[model samples]
Target: MTAFVLVAGAYTGDWVWHDVAAQLRAAGAGAHAAVLTGMGSGAPAAPPGTDLERHVRELVELVDEIGDPEVVLVGHDYGIHPVLGAAGRRPGRITRVVHVDTPLVQDGATALALVPDPAVHQALAEGPAHLPPPASREAWQRWGSTDGLDDATLGRLIREAAPQPPATLTQPLRLTAAATELPLTGVLCIANGSSIATVQSLVELGDPRFQALADPRITYLELATGHWPMLSAPDGLAEVLLASAKGEGRRVTRPAEGELPPHLRPFLLDLPERRRERVGRVDLYPPEADGPRPAVLFVHGGPVPAGVEPTPRDWPTLVGYARYAAGLGVVGATLDHRLHDLSAYPRAAEDLAAAVDLVRADPRVDPDRIALWFLSAGGLLCAEWIAEPPPWLRCVAAAYPILAPLPNWGPFEPRFRPAAALGRAGNRPPIVLLRVGGERAEIASTVEAFLAAAEGTAADVEVIDLPGGTHGFETTDRSEDARRAVERTMRAVLDRLES
Candidate 1:
């Protein structure tokens, strides 16, 4: 007796949900495909004033009219905005809220802010009041992956798609506390680069922002299809929705209370602490007998939540490595960059460059003998330095880094791929790579690709493999091999710095 309200993302309408709705109805559930104010077959061209709030009102009115005793609300992509707003207004009536292949956007966040493409940003900012839908397959890929969709469905989508109102993208979504309190389900599109494992990894980072995702009330289901699952796998999407209503999807496990996540655990190597000095946003651990010694700048990986406490500079692994480097007769520096999320890479790269400048300018460090060490997600930031090494730069090092964007990280700039950048280097600095045997397949594949790209390059590429290590192995593995790998990698970096 549960009634389902289905909402489609930008450029589509109720038509996009037709197959799913039919399947839902055949299974004895009531389904309503919502047609927003500026979309669908009979609707007029979106007016200048058509915004998010207008769409919310439309959904609210539909829910009121349906008056089903039990109601489940489903939202896909851009459709999540109105679904959240409407749920906020009618919290008591909504049984559960399902997010389909979209991020859980916070209050007052605009879709424009979450999108990573600069071209999309420009189009929404300076183009027409209503942005037109994709005219071809290439353009569609920019919006989301087109995997699993046949040519007929792709053509139908292009021909029937509606123009998106600019205000819908730019306007902020407002939500109430009661709405967030409702039971939630997330249907992740794995082929589009997100899966239950990805969500679980984020939760394991111990970030407060992702803590709520571990709550038992939240469930996750993986769809091995493209972003538009309703179009590509309608029956599967319908089944998932039904399962979601029954609270049957997998739940992400949290660390036991008072226990730290693996990344936050103490570093495996035991090293004496050195006197630490703070320089702007950088933390310096200068060697005791330093006479303008060679420096190694450590960059921590993220798309870490901006609000996460202790920050990356203070992470046990970074702190431990910095202190250990100081013990080896070099100035070791750790920096706090602005890589707060996927979209902030450019700003994060700029912050890292500035930190390098700050470190080189310090009187205790040798400006011409600096080495850069990158970790985890921070690995992509090394692409620029590798592509065009500065005369003063001596070496580049990365540990368990993502060298290429994941398949699901849609429409990324080609310049950020380290594997591709290797081909563009003229006088590249020596490269030291630390590969983990037990790393996630997605990340491990990126490292393998980078290695293949380095096959015949003039650069001196040395790889130190940890046979039984995981990503963030310094704290997670805690084995003899892990300690030795860390030591070997550090020694290799020092060799390049002192050369």
Candidate 2:
């Protein structure tokens, strides 16, 4: 019989897995909940020196005591650190490892480093050795969404929560190569804000960090509860865990090498290449008969992985658009911004601003007649320009752009919200938005929200809808409709530029 080792996240420990353990036992599986040091009811207070390694050692000891030949090690939230450490040390005993509502942390990474709130980081850096759990029911939301928890559960959670040792979070987790070789399963709690589709989208972006997710040995399952799925839906969680042990869940397949992802396919229009010049980080394609001509600067979407080769400036669609703009008697430009990840939006905005200044300073470009075109995730960058359009900025265009952050992004800055910015704007540039019918639901919702917000604004907004197109349709959808839409969009932007 397969044995299961259940681990709970911060604060409460063995008790958190009680219900799930019961269900697992009823289903003919041996379930053991390993309570980490400095946690669980009646557990002794941890010393300042009690770190992640100590907790990992505690879990390793439990596995040794259980002495099960086939062990399915399950980790939830903060518990993953110790679980991974133990698995790395005993790879021969662990058959499969399951991660519940936690990120895939790399070796040398600390739990505190993954925490999004800067205030939490500051407090942890300067505060006591032990961090107290939430004092009030409402405060629990900081850890994760409290969507499905009942009043009794919430009350009990706060009452029984233990102080988390600061060292446990700050200490790095070290893993051996054998741990990675074990089969893995990820359980995402959608109500707390993540789903299979979200993972697929990140993988689709060609982010190298997520490339391993496509391996057949890894599987994904979703629970429609909050972060504490064991409390909210214990039976459901048990079922998923059983299914995971059997290697039954959705698996994302990676495209073969030399095969293009939907987003990287060939551009719809095949335009002739123009004279290209590298202006610092920006690529420029000046029109043939140009003497200080109007310029269109294209910003490609992505918190693209920093190591992605060829860069956004060299992408086929961006190059195609730049060349197409040059054909329209305008100076075309494409730039590489530093939106390396979700947290680097401010830096990306700064990079884009610097690129804009560089483009305007060029002697061959008409600085006062510039248009900005944004794509995909780059749409968020449009918020600043739309909120306060400079006199030189004539028009703005976006192609299947994400105007708002997805729910999974978690507590993004309000300043990056283009929809909200549009609502508060006075005078703005003419906006040309290309909407794709078959766009991903998350991205499509943002586009709809942007349009809804635009309805209340005085800013001139025009939407060109492609009834049969998908996100990144310029390359993915090779239909004649997509080609016409691309042509129409280009013409519309050029008309505004020349106006």
Candidate 3:
């Protein structure tokens, strides 16, 4: 299907993306663009209660009219939901969404809502009336203007700019796709030339919320052009649009069903069931069919409050999600974990060891290829596993993991050491993240915030910004940044696993 656009933000219309649209067509994509209700590129202002329907209609109409197997959807500014709503209404028709510097408003939120800038949000509401306004001048001065555009181009943009409808600004979109799954990419364009780049949270897509999109699949990109890259860096913007259509923009690995254990399948897709009194659970996968492959028994990212065992879906990077595990073709499996109340330190590690014993009990799993993917508490548990180190677990991949609250891995990173790790050589060389005073920032809170505010201010070279938020948020919808952070870390893990 054709590439579609829903112009959002600043009471603008589809005309704004004209420069981008042209480049996309040149790049071999059939593209269509729509102006949302209330704001028009040239049309006079409309009446009240005009919702995002115009934008949605433009998208849906293009999809329906094309009759293609699937289409690539693009949204600029605040068009995320309008396009997403249209996509959700007809999920099968849209192959993927290109969130081109688009604010992904799911339910009633604008891109402006993400940052704490109310004044700009208000200006945005007044629609065309407020804009080309005094405030925008500063933003424009700082980030707008094309080095190559002439007076004619400038006059047309200034004259036709429409005020954004207050209704569109106020109406919260109900992100229907939250329940259904879809792939989306949010390109963070520092159009204003702001040193920092962002997607502006439908509040921060970090670990939790994004895990819904899963990793190695949902793409994220940042561009150097000012906000209206379409007007200035049209060529570059068009390149990105073409990449979106091709599905080769950003590649990620997801789990394939072939790697899953025969018994694990029903349990993975099934609802909570009576898990027999098993010591622990070990998950696995290999590269090819019926072949021995490297497997990981990721025993981390603690479980939720409701149950004793971790539902694969509950964890931030819910283990055994076929879409996720299939990536890298790594055999990704996790035990039905027991987190809070019914759990303690040694008990979990012992159970893990037994679980490994069980896997070793099977002929399919290559014990030599086993690795431990430990998160936070699980990291410490993995340290215990290494004390005597189970014969099965060959390597350890510790993520934002807590390896005995060392004096270093703390400030905000909890360092409480479990008694089980007492007197043990806790120097396990796992691929670790937030170890307090960490060399690299774990994609966790505090760290991500630090990165956000300290845009250029130099801090500790060892002090990195962890967008992933503290370890726990990795697999949950709680933090979108954390999800990307975890995915980045996953690549590293894959590299290490292969090495």
How would you order the candidates by TM-score, starting with the best?
A: 2, 1, 3
| TM-score of every candidate relative to the true structure | 0.81, 0.84, 0.44
Residue ranges of candidate 2 with Cα displaced over 4 Å = 1-3, 12-31, 41-48, 64-69, 134-161, 189-211, 214-216, 223-239, 252-257, 260-264, 288-293, 362-366, 406-412, 437-461, 465-469
Rank order by lDDT, top first?
1, 2, 3
RMSD of each: 4.0, 3.7, 15.6
lDDT of each: 0.88, 0.86, 0.49
- lDDT for each residue of candidate 1 in 106-201, tens digit (9 for 90 to 100): 899887765545566788757577787889988887777677899999999999988889888888999889888889999988767677867887
RMSD of 2: 3.7
Off by over 4 Å in 3: 6-8, 42-44, 67-69, 103-112, 120-136, 139-159, 178-180, 190-214, 251-499
List model 3 lDDT by residue over 14-109, tens digit each: 787777777767766666666445555554456655655655665566567775465777766566657777877778877787776544454655
**Weakest 10 consecutive residues, lDDT, candidate 3?**
194-203
Of the two candidates 2 and 3, the one with more favorable TM-score, higher being better, is 2
